[model samples]
Target: MPNQAYLRVAGLSKRFGSGENAVAAIENLSFTLDEGRFLSILGPSGCGKSTLFNIIAGLMAPDSGDVTLNGESMLLRPGMTGYMLQKDLLLPWRTVADNIILSQTLHGVRRSKALDAALPDARACGLETMLRRRPDELSGGQRQRAALVRTLQTGKPLLLLDEPFGALDAITRLHLQELLTDVCMKKDKTVLFITHDVDEALLLSDEVLIMGSQPGRIIAHYHLPQEKPRTLKTLALPRLIEIKGEIMQLLDQEVKRHDPHA
Candidate 1:
C-alpha cells in the first residue's frame, strides 16, 4: 500500500488571458504527496509543467483550485513556500551560511540563533567547509547543495523545484541528483520537483506524474514501489525501467496528440 498523503491538491486549474487567447495551463489537475515524500513531474516542453509549479508554489493563482497542507487548507504566499529554480540564485557577496540564515532573519528569526540551528544540516550536505566561502569559489554541485540547504532553512514542509539541476552537464546532473536524493530524504521534505529528464525523475521521485501538453492535464500517474535510501543503483533496477517505459509511452503519445498536423 502507499504511504499516507500529507499534501492534497484538489480540482486544480489555471488559465492565462481571456476568451480565444486564454489557454489552460493545467486543468482539473490533482495529485498527492505524502509527508516527507518526493514527487517528480515530467513532460515535454510547453506541457505547462512550470505553470503547474507556479500555482503549487503560490507564486500565481489558479483560475479555480486549492492546495491543502498536512490536512489543513494552505494560505500560500511568497517566502511561505521555498522554491528552488534552475539557477543557484545565490548572492556573490554573501557566504553560504549567511545565505541560509537570511530567510530566517527576514521571517524574524534571530541571526545568531538561525546560524546556530543551521549548522547541523549544513554540515550534512557537505557545506561545513564551504559555508565561509563565496559562491564563486564553489563547484557547481556544491553551489546547488547550498541552494537546497537554503531552501530547507525556510523550514517549510514543501519545496518547489523547477529543474534545479537541469542546467548542469550530464555528469554533474547525475552526481547532484544522487546527492540531492540523499539530502531531501534526510530532511524529510515534501518535494514537488519538476524535470524534463526521465532518468533523473525516476531516480528521485516516489511518485511520477506524466503530463500532456496544451490544455494540459495529467495523462498518467505512476507510483514507485521502491523504498527509500535509493541510490544510483536504483536506476538499474528492472522495475524502475519498467515504470519509466510507461511514462515515456505516455509522453510519446502526448507529443503526437499535440502535433498531429505537424
Candidate 2:
C-alpha cells in the first residue's frame, strides 16, 4: 500500500547451461510484490513460472537479478518462506500431525512441543482425526489439506504455492480455493502462487500477473480489486466476465502460437 515494496524483484533473470546449451527462463524481469496480498503468476507451460518461484524461494539463484525482502536483500534463510509443491509431498511413514511438525523439528523444536503447538491449527484443517493416520490413508483432498496446514505451520511470511489444488476435482478445487482464501486472511500472509488455470487466478488473486513464454517475462498485471470472500456467484458478474474474457483472449493467442493444432 505504501511506496516501499514488501518484496522487490529487480532485473530478475535466470539462465540454464552455457553457450549453445543455454536457455533463459526469465530475461531481466522485474516486479514488486506488495505485503499482505495474494499475487498470482499465470502462464502457459514452460514459461518459467516455477523457475521464478524457485529463484524467489532461494532454491535457485538468478544469473542476473536482485531480490530484496522488506528493503533488505533476501538471504538464503530456509524457514523464512514456505513452499508447497504441486504434489502434497507427504511422508507416508509419519502421521498427519507429524508431517505438519516436521519443519519445527528441523528448527530444533522437540516432538512433544511440536505436536502440542501444531494440534489446534492442524485440527482446523480437518486433519484432527487423521493425526494418528498415515499419509497413505488420506484422500487426495485430505492430503492437500494436510499439505496446506503443514505449509502454514511454518509461520512463513512468503507462501509459494505451486498449483497446490491442481490435482483435485473441480468441486474439491473450488472448496480448497475458498479454504485457502480463509487461511491466508486469518494468517495475514503474503502469498505468490503459480497456477495455469485462469479462473483459479481470478478467484484467489488480489492481482494476477501473466508471464510470456520462452524467455519468460511479465506480460500483464491485472488487479482483481474485489473484496474478500469472492464467490462463484461473483464470477458471474459483468466485470468478472469482462476480466475473464480479457485473460482468455491472451491465453487463446498464446495457445495458438504455441500449439496451433491444440
Candidate 3:
C-alpha cells in the first residue's frame, strides 16, 4: 500500500507589501510529504523557497491556504516541527552537549537527563570527545553535526531543513548527507528539505519538487527510485545522472521562462 500523507500544504499563498507594489512570493502552492519520507524542494534563488519554509515553520503566515501536520492545522504553532536552517545557529556560550540538549532543556527535560539522552547521538556523529567544548572551539562541520543532534533531541515527528549543509565544504557536505540519511531512516522521521543543489536533492530525497519563479509554485515532481538508501556511490548510477539532467533541464526552462533575454 502507498504511504499516507503525514504533512500537507494546500493552495498556500503568500504576498509581500500591498497594492501595486505587492509581490506574490508563493501562489497556490500544494504538496504532500509521506510519513517517514524525505522530500526536497528545488528552485532558483528568490523563487520563494525560503518563504515557503518560513510559512511551514510557522514563522510567517500565508495570505491564504493551510498547512497541516498529521491531518491537523499547524498555523502559528512553531513547535509542531523541528527546523534546521542554513546556519547551525549554535549558542556560543554553550558546550557541544549543552547545545545539543538545548531544546530538551527548554521543554523542562532535566539537564542531566537531556545530556544523557544526547550522548548516543553525539557519539554516533563522532562528537563524543568534544561534548564539553563550546561552539567556538569546534570546526564548522562539527558545529553542524552538533546542531543536527540538537534538532533530533526535540523528538518531533517532522523535520524541516532549509539548506542546512549549503555552507559546508563539499567533502563535509557529502558526509553530513550520509549521516542525515542514516539518522532519518533509523529514527523514521519525516523530512522536508529545501535546497538549490540538484545533486544534493537527488541524493537525499525520495521525491523532488521543482519550483518556478514569479510567484513560486511547484511546476514539476519526480519520484526517485529507492531500491536502497542512497550514498555517495549512488552518484555513479546512470539513473541518478539521468534524473539530474532532467531536473537541470526543468530548472533551466523555468529560468528562461521568467527571463526571456537569458
Candidate 4:
C-alpha cells in the first residue's frame, strides 16, 4: 500500500481582494507529505510558495479546501507547526539558550526543564558553546543554527521552513543544509521547505514539488532515491544531475510564463 499522508492539502485555494480586481494566490493546490518525510517546494517568486506555507502554518486561511495533519484538521489550530523563516528572527536581547526555548516558554514549559530538553539539540546544532551569548555576538550561521534549534524545541511534528538558509553564505548554507537533514531525520520530523535553489531541494528532500506562478499550483513532482548520507557526492551523480536539469527547465518555463519579455 502507498504510504499514508501525514500532512494533506486538499484542493486548497486562497484569494486576496474581491471582484474583478481579486487575485488568487493559490488555486486548487494539493499535495501530501508522508510522516517523517522531507518535502521541498520549488517555485519562482510570486508563485504563492510563502502564501501556501502561511496557510498550512495556520497563519492564514484558505478560501476553500482543508489542511490536515496526522488525520486532524490544522485549520482550527493556528500555530500547530513549527515555523522558521529566512531570517533567524531571534530576540537579540535574549541569550542563545533563551531564544532556543522561547516557544517552550510560551507553552508553559519551565525554563529549567526547557533548557534541559533543548541541550541535546543545541549541542547537535553546534550552539552548545554559545548558548550564553546574545544573538548579536554570534555569526550569521550561528544565529540561524540557534533559530533551527528553537524550531525543533517546539516539539511540533511538522516543520515549515521558508528558505531558512537563503541569506547565508554558500559554505554556511551547505553546512546547515546537511545539519538540518540530519537533525530532522533523527527527530523524525516532517518538513515542508520552500526554496528557490533546485540543488538544495534535491539534496535535502525525499520528494520535490515544482510549482508554477500566476495562481500557484503544482507543475511536477519527483520522488528521489532513498540514498543515505546524501551529500555533495550525491548531487554529482548523473541521475541527480538529470533531475536537477529537468527541475531547472520547469522553473525557467514558469519564469517566462510570468514574464515572457525576460
Q: Which candidate number would show the highest lDDT if scored against the true structure? A: 4
What is the lDDT of every predicted structure here? 0.83, 0.87, 0.90, 0.92
Q: Pick the TM-score winner.
A: 4
Cα lDDT over the full model 1? 0.83
CA lDDT for candidate 2: 0.87
The predicted structure with the larger lDDT, 2 or 4, is: 4
Instruction: In angstroms, give how far residue 87 of model 3 lies from its true place.
Output: 0.8
How well is each residue in 1-262 modelled by candidate 3, as lDDT tens digits? Answer: 6554679899999999999999999999999888998999999988999998888888899999999987888877788789998899999998888899999999999999999898898888999999889899998999999999999999998998999999999999989998999999999999999999998998889999999988899989889985447776787799888888989999999988888887
Can you list the residue pairs that collide in candidate 3? none
Model 2 C-alpha lDDT per residue in residues 57-160, reported as the tens digit of each score: 88787888788889877645545688999899999899988999888898999999989988877877878888999999999999999999889888788899
Specify the poorest-scoring 10-residue window by lDDT in model 3. 226-235
Query: TM-score of every model?
Result: 0.91, 0.95, 0.96, 0.97
* Candidate closer to the true structure by lDDT (higher is better), 1 or 3: 3
Worst 10 residues of 2 by lDDT: 71-80
lDDT of candidate 1 at residue 77, scale 0 to 100: 57
Minimal lDDT window, size 10, model 1 = 71-80
Q: Name model 3 segments beyond 4 Å from true.
A: 1-4
Candidate 4 residue pairs in clash (backbone atoms < 3 Å): none
Please rank every candidate by lDDT, starting with the best.
Answer: 4, 3, 2, 1
**Which whole-number lDDT from 0 to 100 does residue 196 have in model 2?**
84
After TM-score superposition, the amount by which residue 117's alpha carbon in candidate 2 deviates from its true location, in angstroms, is 2.1
Give candidate 2 misplaced runs (Cα > 4 Å): none
